[model samples]
Target: MKSRRAILAELFLTAASLMALFPLAWMVSVSLMPPHDAVGFPPPLWPSHPTLANYRELFAHQNMGRYVLNSLIVASLATVLSLAFNVAAGYAFAKLRFAGRDRIFRGLLAALIIPGQLSMLPLFFLMKELGLLNSYGGVVVPFMASLFGIFLVRQYALGLPDEMLQAARVDGASEVQIFLKIVLPNLRPIMVTLGVFTFLSAWNDFLWPLIVLSHDQLYTLPLAVASLSREHVQDSAMVMAGAVVTTAPVLVLFLALQRHYVRGLLAGSVKG
Candidate 1:
């Protein structure tokens, strides 16, 4: 009976996994199919005669490489800055003692309830005032780990041993030293988790970048994909190829860090 249940669970999980991956697999299949075939009445699952012409056209005519580079640059910058800023701020909130600290942190948590979309108009206006509209800085300036990220870090940081921090303080270690030497080392797993979110969010972002980056040269991959879709409305294969290009990096990144991400979340879940 136990063996029967185990087999049933394995089958269920395998089926679910295949179900989830089917779209990506189909996208790849469609991207490789002859250009017009992907949109035909039958819509074949696998290409009858797989060809590289779509990808060739994408690179040669569309200048998609530039969009890929833009995404990498913007996402990398956002990840690093978000990790640095959020980690420090989160650690301060978790450990440091100052007046109204809890109150301020609670207010930040409360702010999460408000929808982010509601702020876009004001944010765009503020960008216009700062002379950051239609620029890389505009994208990077607003791209950072969000409120939920801060909460994640704070919850994880609270798990750090207070006695270890006290001992470091006794040894004349400055706050910066303690943060660098003690907090960061203990915080590695959660940092990887947060980095994944920050990087993926920036890479996948479209609406803000659309509002800011009016110039062709500044467009990121998602924006480029949307533009390509509009221009090549009939070319489903090309659009699918562009999607694979945009999605590949994030998938690779998440797969690489998934172990750490799981550990971090599992450990942080019980924090008070």
Candidate 2:
């Protein structure tokens, strides 16, 4: 049942996948290698003497566990807050009637084109003024409500049956109760998509956290990995191990939830 073209396409895709994955695979392989073995010309693909020494060095000497915990705390808080704010705002934009709603949403959508970097200075100053600087709240607050998140949720929520919402309203359900009881359950796919997006963004964030967190105790995994690279410049294997540790959790989370993420994107794209 397969044509030559189909076979060729499959082969091309397989090759592309392997090519994309090769570097990550090599990173893991190098992480397992002994120090300096990875820096050799024509680096070996497999470790001759695999060991956990680099990981041990990272956790034991570098205090990497604290960084991991910090990242977890920041990312979890950001994801939860992003869901809370973006979901409500998005649903309101989609289904609720309010004065100036369209104009406000249009202004937000227009803002999507502006570079996010431009806002950093003002945001930093705002954080400083609020006394949130140099704290976890500083890292989490900026990402708690994002325009893209609002747009994604709004687009997906547009597809929800208006009749169901109206019926809930007629039954004398308060807006909060209706949203909690009716809307949230229907918005599961998009919620997962948004949550995963927020979590990954917060987890891997480097620059904002770097600027905001002053204490070594507050360093996140990306910052920790960067610092490790600086301290262990010659120890490529150790650096690779640090990279692996920084990358692995989010990679696992994405792989686990990719189906839902893809479905949400697809549904949102067409629903509006």
Query: In candidate 2, what are the lDDT values of residues 147-265, reduced to their tens digit?
Result: 88899999889999999999999999999999999999999889999998889989999889888887888989998889888877778888888899999999999899998767666
Residue 3 local lDDT, model 1: 95
Q: Model 2 residue 214 lDDT?
A: 79
Record all residue pairs in model 2 with backbone atoms less than 3 Å apart, i.e. clashing: none
RMSD in Å for model 2: 2.2
Global fold similarity of model 2 (TM-score): 0.92
Question: Candidate 1 on 222-257: residue-level lDDT in tens?
Answer: 999999988877788998899999998888888988
Scored by Cα lDDT, where does model 2 land?
A: 0.89
Would you give me the overall lDDT of model 1? 0.86
Please report, in order, the local distance difference test score of every candidate based on alpha carbons.
Answer: 0.86, 0.89
